[model samples]
Target: MTRKILHVDMDAFYASVEQRDNPDYKGRPVIVGGPPDSRGVVCAASYEARKFGVRSAMPCSQAARLCPSGIFVTPRFEAYRKVSSRIREIFLEYTDLVEMLSLDEAFLDVTENKKNIPYASQVAKEIREKIFEETRLTASAGVSINKFLAKVATDQNKPDGMTIVRPDQVEKFIESLDVGVFPGIGKVTLKKMHALGIRNGKDLKDKSLEMLDQSFGKSGRWFYAVCRGLDDRPVEPYRERKSLGAESTFPKDLENSEEILRELADIAEELERRLLKKPFPGKTITLKVKFSDFTQKTRSLTEDYTYIDKNELYRIGSKLLGEFLLGSGKSVFPIRLLGLSLSHPESSSKITTVNTEEEDDLFPSLF
Candidate 1:
């Protein structure tokens, strides 16, 4: 029997929450992030803002430049998380095989769902309707026999779109797709593929296994499978976040040292909230920055201790930001994006295991 999977993604989740709570924000370009003066990046942009080319992870300052009249506000995760919880509650009503990809997205296995919906397309539609009725927010749903195709279907339509791919159509659909559209094909891979004259899925399908293996190592096998429209990965019920982070890009490149530090503080605060709730015992605190030309760099400091407190983590992040910003020799370009992440140490493996089991079993209803 063919399996069924559904991918549900909330449209403009953070910005939508802000618009929902504030009557004045309706129909306006709203950006949820820090102030432009603080070297802020766009955390999320409303559809109105998106019309002007503003996007999440873009610089808040640049977003304002795109739509000068847009309203820029800091993110309120407490409010957003409450909305996320409501959305998750809706997913559980259908299936026990619910896997949350993030607060705003998830995968549902309805092949044996409690609601007994036989057609996966019908299940997708119901999830979309329920999200709208309960949350007053729009969502996009994708229905297919596997995770890969389902995710692809979800993106086919945007701002509340639904797409369904039957089992038989999978191979044909993949054959016509662009290589860059495949998941895990990053900038580096795109460059390498271009050099090899492999432009799309059809080009990829022509490669021999030995050739692909030589180029991508173990990943070559996975790439070969994708070309044949084969994915056996299950709809994971729970995914413990390996890291929790918040990042923002600047509107204009930021050469200002003071502004960069301020944005880091804001990202640190958001990361802190996630850490406190999840109790990340990891020893690594990583800082990610992207330059104006999209060059990215990451710096990390690992400690022997796990941190649950917000203040201590913030201090360390601030210190790291200073170290990077106050370089003696080279002049730094304007900052485009800043990110902060906290990873627990390996020593906490036992605790992490316990937490994972508890989250999956004890709170199965929460998925």
Candidate 2:
């Protein structure tokens, strides 16, 4: 049986929420994240901001430079999470096969939904309407036979839009797609593909399997299948999160070890709050550092038992940061980002014991 996959993404989630809560922000360029004076990145940019070449993940400072008049606002994650929960409730009304990707996006497998909806597109339409009716926010949806096509289609007509790719249209759709737009093809990979004259799906299809394998290894093989619209990856509704983490980029890179430790304390506090909200017993604590030069590294330590003690997390995090600084020999002074994550809890083992096939049958392409 052909599967019915729907990818739903909120349009400018954080920015839109800000605008919705504050009528004065409506129709104006809103940027959410760290302040422009700090070394932070843009978390979300409104459509109006995007027109000024502002984008998520771009440096907040750069975004400010791009749109001098843009209103910069800090993210209200709690509010966003509340909306996300509400949206998930709506998804559950139709199917238990909903796989949340993040606070702003999810993929639903409605092939055997609770509502017994016959048309995937109709399910998507109703879901969007329900989301708007409850939250007063816009969502874009893509409906197709598999996750790949559904995800790509979601972006075709965005911000309160829906696009459907019927099974019959899959082949032609794949053939005409630009190679750069295919999932997992980054700038570096795109450059390599261009050198090999693989500019589009047709070009990718023309390459021999052996040649592609020699050029790109396992990813090449995966690309070969995806370019032909043959993605069988299941939507795994039961995929357990292996780790929970939070990170922050500073307004200014930290040059002093004391300053770094202070920042780590604040981050640890935030992590504790998160753990309290979604309590997890993780034994391993990992610290992430991104230096000013764009180089990144991680250090971790494991305990005998899982715990979520704030002081312990902070102690471990600070120790990790101290060790990194001491090892640096005063060289790598400025650090752009710092992060903390908890993992390797006892519950994770139990996650794998669930019936994989059953989960797959109910949900597709969760990861």
TM-score of each: 0.69, 0.69
Off by over 4 Å in 2: 243-367
For candidate 2, lDDT tens digit of each residue in 1-367? Answer: 9999999999999999999999999999999978988766677899999999997656688999999999999988899999999999999999998888778888899999898889999999999999999999999999999999998889889889999999999988888888887754644457668888989889999988888765654456777788788888788777676777666555457877777877777667556645543446677777777676656666677777675555677888877776557654442558866777788744322211121111111111111
Across residues 28-120, which tens digit of lDDT does each residue of candidate 1 receive? Answer: 999887797656567788999899999765666788788898999888878888999998898999998898876788888999988887788
Backbone atom clashes (below 3 Å) for every candidate = 14, 8
Model 2 RMSD in angstroms: 10.4
Model 1 sits at a Cα RMSD from the real structure of 10.1
lDDT of 1 at 225: 82
Model 2 residue 327 distance off true place after TM-score fit, in angstroms: 17
- Per-candidate local distance difference test: 0.72, 0.77
